[model samples]
Target: MSTATPAHSSAQSGTAAIQSATIETRDWLIAAAAAIVALIALYAVFMDNGSLISATGDYLHEFAHDGRHLFGAPCH
Candidate 1:
């Protein structure tokens, strides 16, 4: 007698099984560090107002003036 299995017993194609993903502490730390750096850059670009990096006259101000208007942050 033949011992072949039925066609319905085969695995499905194209679709993958679900998985449970977890974030470790190191991953969170890296993400937080990147976020902090991005925030500092954003501050320098939009809300600097020549307070933190404006020691050399209006260089920073002038440099980011067009950017301020483009972002609608109001530098005037």
Candidate 2:
């Protein structure tokens, strides 16, 4: 025998709890910008070979070198 229950139970028998949240257009834009920045950073960390930000010299390469090797990317 088994009993079934909703994941979230409320004081009201038939109604699930509702939590109200709002995100403005500005907030969405900011979040999108942040996501893009994060993706760019990830690409720089993993796929960049001193071309995207070559002004930084080999700093980025050396910084993420161990990470590349750890992820089994052939740096040689």
Candidate lDDT values, in order: 0.69, 0.72
Checking candidate 2 for backbone clashes, the offending pairs are none
User: Candidate 2 lDDT, tens digit per residue, 1-76?
Assistant: 1233443343443342222123355678899999999999988887788788769877787899999889876674
11-66 in candidate 1: lDDT tens per residue? Answer: 32212221112335567889999999999888778778677654745666679999
Worst 10 residues of 1 by lDDT: 12-21
**TM-score of model 2 (CA atoms):** 0.59
Query: Clashing residue pairs in candidate 1, if any?
Result: none
lDDT of 1 at 65: 94
Runs in model 1 with CA error above 4 Å?
1-23, 54-57
The top-ranked prediction according to lDDT is: 2
- Model 1, TM vs. native: 0.60
In terms of lDDT, model 1 sits at 0.69
Give the CA lDDT, 0 to 100, for residue 30 in model 2: 93
Candidate 2 at residue 6, lDDT?
A: 45
